[model samples]
Target: MLKKVRTVLDDVLDIERILGKISQDKANPRDIIGLNESLKCIPKLKELLHLEDIKKLNSAADSFADTAPVVELISEKLNEEVPAQLQQGHVFREGINKELDELRKLASGGKQWIAEMQESEREKTGISKLKVGFNKVFGYYLEISKIHQDKVPETYIRKQTLVNAERYITAELKEYEEKILSAEEDIMAIESELFAECCQKILDRADLIQINAKLLNRLDVLTTFAHLAIQKKYCKPALVSDAVLDIKDGRHPVVENLLPASDRFVGNDLKMNVDKSQIHLITGPNMAGKSTYLRQVGLIVLMAQVGCYVPAKKATIGMVDRLFTRVGASDNLAGGESTFLVEMIEAANILNNATAQSLILLDEIGRGTATFDGLSLAWAITEYLHNHKAVAARTLFATHYHELTELEHTLERLQNHHAAVKEFGDQIVFLKKIMPGPGDKSYGIHVARMAGLPGSIISRAKDILNHHLEESMDQSGTSISPEASKQLSMFEQQEAKFKKDLDEVDVDSMTPIQALQKLDELKKKHGL
Candidate 1:
């Protein structure tokens, strides 16, 4: 059982690099129809093992990877598959069903038997109804009414000796009393044993039910794989196709459908032809389709490896031991780590452990840091993935820093890719298409403007940029001598004084009259 669980964990978890589609929620398949919903069968997978006719179904289970499609095709032809699966007390479901039935019958019989026994006691004692119940130092009992006292026989009276304040039973009544008391004991004993057995049976049946549930879950997984194959229009690949990941006509499944036809995706075709080679650097603009392309690759690999047909028109996949994704945002409030710190920890985990057969998808690897630090780290990580690590696992590294694109020239078996974009005057539109080569420009300011920034802010940003550009040029042409250092210090002192004077004005509290007085005072102080 543990081994089977381990197998499932490998396939179900770590979804970063498999393919471009989210796995359907396995536990609920009611909303899903056809083979896509087949995954729902996993909870009942264990049932296949316990049936008396499971011997006949062995062929179906053993050949599940291949000829199981025949079962689906046959079911489709006969139209009996669904009803058969839904029935309770299926040969496999009967063990649990029978146990539950037996328990219910035992409880019902126990109640009925007790009721009849009580009626017999009432008839024998001439006690038509239960009037009062009492427990004395001797035994439990039902008391008779004064009107029914005459119904007692002479033998009961003759044997009686006045032993109580009211009336007492003779030896004759004692014998009858023993009979009633014995009947109750007998009924109680039978009920105790019967109920204990029922409880035990129920517990056993519950265990069997749970086991059957797990088996059904496994069955659902198999069916899901078959359904995926049909949808992708591909045959299930042999286990030997273990080393191949071929995706033909692959589009980002989620994106392609949601986007308009005019803005629809251009598919990505990547065949990792080299063994021990897994890293491709992707450089593009802010709104370019790099992230989408990476996600597509990851989703595709995930689907294929899990034995499901991929979203691509055609694909033959390999087993990825682990798929690690360091994409998107994560908040780390409890850990007291910032967004960038969380990103770094995840990246570190991937870099430290990823192997040749592992799939790693990294998006904007170092974008959480300062410009130079982030770019440098991104560049180094790309180099490490390309040159140092086991390349057997595939990697898709996406970044906006174009300088890292230089790696394509430096590393063998390394390739450059980017998402395409179109420029419209000052407005650059993202095409959201993956293509070969790196992007040439960083449209950070352009994107910012498009997101709604005032014209005045844009102009101010441009002026600051120009001033910094000029300062850089001068710094590169000159040396920092002692005289220059002294001048810099004097400039800093004067700037400090100017800032102190500016801070002296309390703009928030100043009224209109105070503002006019301050303007005149400023004009006199500066001789304006």
Candidate 2:
């Protein structure tokens, strides 16, 4: 029944858009016609739904309204061929009003009126060659041959003198021409009044029409979802009351659709539980589908609750009351607070509002601030979510801060996942696949190299990284502390500043004594 209904409803117009255009006092002919046509589609739906074969399904037909009266009223008055605007005047059936019909006839028959005037004037003047002519330059004129110039009356004003004839405009011709020209305005005035009256009749039943519009919209959305589910090979998700979100081979709906015909989006699997695996700590490098993985799980859960098929091989979702996301950097409009402040504010909102039933997706949560501050906040937020039951929502957190992955052993409910990457010497490829366990490396410099950075900058960055690693890590590189990393980072910053100052010294411009004094100042500042 729904398949048949979906096809018939293809003709249903956008009644909601049409209703928005209706004026309080004016009847927009175009909008009214749209409303009428949309309502007319209800009968087809009613016929399909009012089936006795299934007897119990008859209740669905009761949802529709009897919009026939509105449809009939609009059809009776609206012209088959409408003008672009009401003032242009063909918006109604010709015989709907007597005055309107008379005005239309007068407006359309101006040529016949002018032809009769020429005959009457020829009889009156006895100029056999006299003719009534009209143009933009000399409107409604009497064109007489130069031979009959003597017969031109004092009442006739010579508007133009031609090569072999004279054009004259008389008071009578001007008076009759004004009537003919004003006939169109009169016709429009009548049509406007009639159109307003007809619109009022329909507006009196606006409530019923609006109700039907909503029902039809619901029907349309369900049918579209049905068609897409079949076309995209989506699966119906199972709903559970407990705290678990399990999806197998789930794909991102938007990214999948946007890929080329030859390319297929790689599907990933996710399973979470409030008691065992409430939080999946995602660690991956840039552009390796971490964000896409986070968004897909959240979207699939949402789709299941919203009564639609999800893009997954199989899904069993715990209903989510609130879905909170802190995915990217954004600044406040006032500019008083920094972007990091904005990130904290959003994080605060999610933390304060989210409950055990909520779903939270945090992508690179601490990337907006200093590394120490960011890592601290990311670590503490994860602990707060795990320790506090009130806010212990199912979370999918993606970050480049690999240190946070160490929390899986500390937090009982936290699990580790990464977007897998493959490296060949200096080159790395984002495999676009999610896999279990924490990532081996962030590959930041490698990602920068892939982004087309200059070779010199890339080489310098690698040198700085290696220097930091050597200074901060243990000899085996198996035991590294954040405290040592912070100290080494400060030392690196100070060293770079001293190097910049030494490189900027002007030996050619400085006197010997002043150069000695500058060297003493640098030695004192650097504790040399």
Candidate 3:
């Protein structure tokens, strides 16, 4: 459809200046030619629009007033081959104006008249080689060889003397020059007047042409988006009044398009409502697609809202009054703000302005600062977005702070989701699939190794990580309250005793019944 439209409208020239000229009544044959070229396609495009079932598209096409009259008048009056500049004549039809037709005949026939005179003079003077010539200094002259100087007619007035010939103009020749020049001047003046009259006919219907022009632009965009949807296999999202956003098999359109043909993007699902899953606390390691998932949801919502098909298998969007996204990081050095400062400013704006009807997308908030500080900020922000009534917006928060996932048990509206990963020895593969539940580890060191970090650096980092793990688990990435200290000590003692007993059990000598009895005793002891 788009290809047919482009082929049909290929003759339509840019009529921006023509439109301006029509308003001022200063349009020339060239501008009218451009205007006619554009308006003539209206009927053809209208025929194409009839093939579409969309009511808006058909109505816009139907709004085109009968512009055939304007196109006909311009086509009839303007010559098939018209000069771009208005002052050059031969722009109008011969019979349109009597005076213009007469002057045109005189101007056009001047060359033949000059040729006849050259032949007549050569015969009368017996100068067989005489030729007619013209130049800026001498308007028109008969050039006679010096050998025929004696035969030159007394009626000839000398104009110029060349090395090989003598240039002379007769009285008839001088008089004809003035008349032909006057005819050309009159021809240009009449053409300008005639061109203006034709332009006036179009200006009378300017409003209708402007309406059709706007309609064509609207149709062009619609058809292009239609083509894009068909090629990309997009779905028409179902927009509703409630505050629920459910998308199935959603993929990021841009990422999908940019991926190499051999690789396929993994699709993910998202469901959000004010009820149970308003805020999704997404956790995963670096290089996972948590940020991509956040942006994909934002883009899908925006696309659906703007009447474009969303890149998903199915989508049901509850119209959001406001959508806020802060997905990536960049420092505005000229503005004297670091990346973390900018992140905070954006977070502040979302916190202060977002409503229950808004959709918020945030990625790796507070990740630029110290780990504990960043984790604390991330945790509190999630709690605020979930608990505050004014800011209880549907949100997708992607972060690497795994400790924040504990909020799933605390906040009713916040759900824990992570980009799933698979591990094999020291290497891990990012599945790029968002799944329910908290991620066990960030795999920061594993990601660093994958990034081509030095082996020594990776080994030292792992050593430091193990040292931190052995020191005290609670004090590492998450804080424990003083109130839970006794509970932690008792649990730690129970684990120690359970390990000691499990070590003492000799599997080689124990029978199946003995093993069952030993596990029951250990469970009771561990409970104590």
User: Which model scores highest in TM-score?
Assistant: 2
Better of 1 and 2 by lDDT: 2
**Candidate 1 at 310: error in angstroms?**
0.1
Please write out the lDDT profile of model 3 over residues 142-212, one tens digit for every residue: 99999999998788898888899899988899899999999888887777777777777777888877777
Candidate 1, position 38, lDDT = 37
Backbone clash count for every predicted candidate, in the order shown = 28, 0, 0
Question: Over 4 Å off in model 3, which ranges?
Answer: 1-35, 51-61, 73-204, 467-528
Off by over 4 Å in 2: 1-4, 23-27, 50-57, 115-153, 158-168, 474-528
Tens-digit lDDT track of model 2 for 234-314: 999999988898899999999999999999899998888999999999988888999999899988988888889999999
As for lDDT, the candidate ahead, 2 or 3, is 2
TM-score of each: 0.51, 0.83, 0.66
Model 3, CA-based lDDT: 0.84
Q: After superposition, how far is residue 444 of candidate 2 from its true place, in Å?
A: 1.9
What's the lDDT for residue 206 in model 1? 41
Question: Candidates' lDDT values, in order?
Answer: 0.57, 0.85, 0.84
Best model number under lDDT: 2
